[model samples]
Target: MLRDLSRPIETGMPTYPGDPDVTLAPDATHGADGYATSRFRTGTHAGTHVDAPRHTLPEGEAIDERDVGEFAFDARLVDLRPLEQREAIAPEALPDPGAIDDDVDLLLLRTGWASHWGSDRYRDHPYLTAATAERCRAADVGVGLDAFGPDPTPTARGDTESPASDGDEPDGTPAHDVLLGDSLPIVENLCGLDDLPTRFRLYAFPLRLRGGDGSPVRAAAEWDD
Candidate 1:
């Protein structure tokens, strides 16, 4: 079976704190121009997007610099749902190394947070700790999630302050630091994991935007019936 794992790009879709707001405007009317085109302005990370090493590491590789094969993921979905608001996803929540297959190159975290995609609660979605990101790095796998990012997002829109709760404070973008620091891709704003099998093939190739720190992708997944 095949399923789309991407969030549709539209005007006014929720974006990360301080990121550019998305806009889609008609550039030419069908009646006037006899052809249609649109003018869209959006941040590279807006909507369902992938993060490249350049997203965090100043010396890291941009999305267009990496080999396209890396974007095709041999993915494993790990469920960690029912978490509390703004909860941290600790390393222990991941499956043991023994349970992982050598063929897996990406780990998609299912926190059941996609249900809150457009609400304020979406920003409060569960997040991965630096430790969890380290685990994925050591395991040689990239990270994906149903929420905004692997790191805790600020609950308020346009707030750039790092999130703090229960006495744990992440250095800004720690998960991105650990993962992208190593050139591992981070996919975010994914949806429909609840309908996918544990193991699947994921394709989320980004546009060949030269020197792009990141890019929005048409992410999709497929699994044997």
Candidate 2:
């Protein structure tokens, strides 16, 4: 059986401060007189979204070329609920890098922070450290997270502090520098990961928007017997 871990984006769904709030303006509705139609203007990274390599790499491949087959492979979920604020996920947090078979590709990090999937809890959640990103890059693990961003903090001056000085670094340099510089694609804002077995088959496919920086995805994974 397959379980979906993606979060839904709704009219009052949590979003970054400056990002547009999700709103529905009904053009026509069955209740009024006809079929329903609406308009949505939200951030590309809103909700459970996938970040293309181009999102960080200056010349990296767009989301279109990233094959869905790549995601439909062996996977494992690492729990990180023990981590406290500002604590980075290091090599020790991972299973024996060599113990994982060559076929494994998808590496899902479940911080258990999804309990606060939205709201301020979504901001400055635990993050992958530089070493963690580097190791994943070396291991060739298709890394994704159930947090806001790979960076525990924001890169811009006022971004992280906007949520009221949660001790997050004002400059989200280290996290982004490693993940983006390595051309790693990060999937964020995932939920219900705790419901899936640690080992499973994942099938996450992003939009094929030609030359586009990134696109939202309906990512899913299946459990084994």
Candidate 3:
């Protein structure tokens, strides 16, 4: 059986703050051009997308440069549901390393955040802590999440303080740094994880956009009955 783990991308769908809004404008219609087509525009990191190493590291590999074999893997789904809004999913939340299959190449975290897909609350969803990212890195597996990104808390949007003044980086994306620093790929905004088994085959191929930092993916899982 096959289950789609991608979130539906539609016009006016909720997007990360400051990211471009999705727009689908008709370019050709059956009544006008004898065909049906539309112009689709969205950010590369839009819903159900994969982030390549270049997403965070300046000298890292781009999505198109990655080997196709990396996109398909044996995945283990870890459920961390019933968490409060803006909660930090620490390393303790993950399953024991011994419990994970030796051959598993991917870890998909299900936080049940998809329930608030189109709401403002979606922006306040929980995120993985830096320690959890390090754990995944140590396991040498790709990671996927049901939230916007891996930061446990939102970055200060309009804060004018600089790192020199605040004694901290204006935007601290530690999760991305640790994972992407090692060239690990991350898939964000996954959905329908509740329908998947603990172990399944994940096929999430990103677009071969040259020099692309990330690309939207049609992520899915296959289970054998």
> By lDDT, who's the top model here?
1
Better of 1 and 3 by TM-score: 1
- List per-prediction Cα lDDT, in the order shown: 0.88, 0.69, 0.82
lDDT tens digits, residue span 150-181, model 2: 77644234555434444534354465556656
Candidate 1 lDDT, 74-152, residue by residue in tens:
9998988779878888889997666789999899999999998887778878888898888888888898999999988
Q: Which residue window of length 10 is worst by lDDT in model 3?
A: 161-170
- Given candidate 1, what's the lDDT at residue 200? 94
Worst 10 residues of 2 by lDDT: 153-162
lDDT of 3 by residue, 81-130 (tens): 88977777888898766667789978888888888887666766776668
- Tell me how many residue pairs clash in candidate 3: 0
Residue pairs whose backbone atoms clash in candidate 1: none
**Candidate of highest TM-score:** 1
Which regions in candidate 1 have their CA more than 4 angstroms from the true location? Answer: 157-166
lDDT for model 1, please: 0.88
Pairs in steric clash, model 2: none
